[model samples]
Target: MQRLPSDPFTSPLWHFVAVLGINGETGQLRPAHHFTGILAGLIYTARAVVAEAALPSQDRAAMADLPERLAAIRKAWLCKSSYAPMGYVLNLLLYGKKIAFETGSRLAVVWNRDGTLLYFQGRPLAMETIRQLIASMTADAEDLLWDGLLFRPRKAEAEAEAGSSSGRRKGLGLLEREGRFLIPLATIRDDLTQTQRGQSFLHTNGLLGKEKEML
Candidate 1:
């Protein structure tokens, strides 16, 4: 299982991507993308986001309002969500888990229960959409989504009893425990930022936004 490579800045016009989290001082943002190599929009921090990355040369006109637009979106996400920028590792982990659980494993558009914030609207994340995108990758693209891999029919059957017989788990006649089982994987800030493809995989994919914990 692996994330497909994605380059979202193809269009001359700026492509809008929602933010998942951010650091206030630095221009870094946690971009929202599915398995399109953006870390499921779950918990990967991106490098600085700018229209300049999309354009071959710096076209001032194309990026004139990028800063203002980014600021506005970041502000909105911070106000309504539980993610805090740069420092709080706990908030980052909770938010990531919440998104993955609610969205059922694919990195798609997610919102708070109140409907004030929306995520990954740029691509409209869904199973079919994800399947189509993966097919576009290569002839033998494998699904790298954590949840899909975790709950696959055969894999689940094989690993249902993988862990200790008494460990807590998710779907197997009240006895299923596999892979991570009860051991929490996300304990520090680095856990959220770490990626199988290396830190570079966390880049914003040429879109934008992040912020502080409000809940």
Candidate 2:
């Protein structure tokens, strides 16, 4: 299929299936596994690095066999393809069941509008995990400080030193709950209320997010 640069969706985007605030986060939203989120970024970055033949040899080998379905979904998403509805794609991409044994209230996480306050397995991540995630995302993570919400680079005495690449993303994040505060196309849950077969898909596949279109 030809790649579509932008969405052609003229109708309402997607049905608000999942009930929000049942836990804490509001509105019907997609919940992709954190690992899958990382993979999405990795593949996006790698595709470019590889095109330039700049990807490291070791990482290149690791990506030899890209997940076909996952890659396909990512393409659809990156291109904002109207033909490939992201709401359906998110359900398809979440690698939930493979990690189903870990599926519990503790495994289910949520986030707020601005992506500041976060809860994992129903609680804030431990300090060490947050530190680790910060470290993974940046080289100057040591210069960063957290103040209950999000991390920010420290203000160094020297102007040049203070503006260092502390905010740079060295790589995709490990654990982050980042998504938008979406307004669903409709206030409907019939798609979810109608069945447990879908729930079975969640168990067997223990899964798994969108946007852009107008005129």
Candidate 3:
């Protein structure tokens, strides 16, 4: 695979996937678990740092070992991949933070200064994608924070009944919903539905408070 841009502002990019490890004996997102969201955060942070540093080269062989290291940590801690955005939403559950959208509702977590666990509707992430991200993380976590790639390889999925009245479908609690969101060149189209939806959310949420109306 070609090198992924470390800058978050890059227009053409891939969405990285992060998987949360669950307990085999018990079911819950563990804060102290070896594979906490911090690993995902740190990985991206490292990528950003590498991008900014005056580095010598971009090599794939070197990147391949990172995931192995991360997996070792997960195993050492006895954590299993829960298939939810637990790594992403775990921060919100721990601190009074937000993802600037319906993420909390979608992830099914509530907020408080004290510790509390909340249930969410989501699926486990694709193992391949998770592997890709772990291998991609370089040794530059500290500097990556400034470039806004601190949480790059994390995504959330939901479950719904076979059919739903509304377009919104309920997400499964612990499995990654299968299907490809990426558009292949052979199946490309001029449709702008996704762009419009993202824009609508930004507009509705006051992110573009003074921006002109976009159709």
Candidate 4:
């Protein structure tokens, strides 16, 4: 079996994956469709970082420790709030025995048995590329955040924006689109919904969306 990178903490990106149960060398659970949530969260966290960074210096210090803030937010959501339900879903997927890809197909999101991300089929994505993908996904997440925080956009406007982004993506090949293998949209949507629900629960429970300790 192919070995993954030696250092787990080498990238902040891996921290997001770890939150989803992918630990060092061995994953806490089997890989499943729910793994998409890690990707989504990575995207959101990366975008949130950028958003905070762009604020005026005075405002920036107020959010200077965003990663720690997000870490606490995620911990409460994953370990405390929805632990049982999330564990149940994880167990179900673990025992469900789904194939990762079609036989004879070289294209796939391959992982080591220990759950380390290997490559998309034959190509190894650069770390920067992975970060770029997260950044792109953050844009989508930002739109939803804006809608929730402020006034909602018209359905037509939302659809148009989504469509235009999709059109822009069409020029790129699947691998090039975000430097990661593409998951089915239905799967991504379901995963995203779960993540959003978790975030909502966190917000309601006073864990996120306000000034808080970086625990």
lDDT on C-alpha atoms for all candidate structures: 0.37, 0.40, 0.35, 0.44
lDDT per residue as tens, model 1, 3-86: 112332332211322333442323576432322233323233321332233322557566677677666544433322423231
Error of 2 at 151 (Å): 28
Number of the top lDDT candidate: 4
**Which structure is stronger by TM-score: 1 or 4?**
4
Question: Which runs of model 4 end up more than 4 angstroms from their true locations?
Answer: 1-8, 12-16, 22-28, 55-215
Across 34-88, the per-residue lDDT of candidate 2 in tens digits comes to: 4344335444564564343443456756675555644664555533333433433
State how far residue 46 of model 2 sits from its true place (Å).
Answer: 1.6
lDDT tens per residue, model 3, 77-118: 212232223322334334422332323333334333333333
- TM per candidate: 0.16, 0.18, 0.16, 0.21
Candidate 2: worst-modelled 10 consecutive residues by lDDT: 206-215
For all predictions, the C-alpha RMSD in Å is 25.8, 26.5, 26.4, 26.8
Q: What does candidate 2 score on TM?
A: 0.18
Q: What is the C-alpha lDDT profile of model 4 across 32-88, one tens digit per residue?
A: 443544444544564455444444457656676766765654443333233433333
Candidate achieving higher lDDT, 3 or 4: 4
Displacement of residue 109 (Cα, Å) in model 4 is: 24
> Any runs in candidate 2 off by more than 4 Å, and if so which?
1-32, 54-124, 128-215
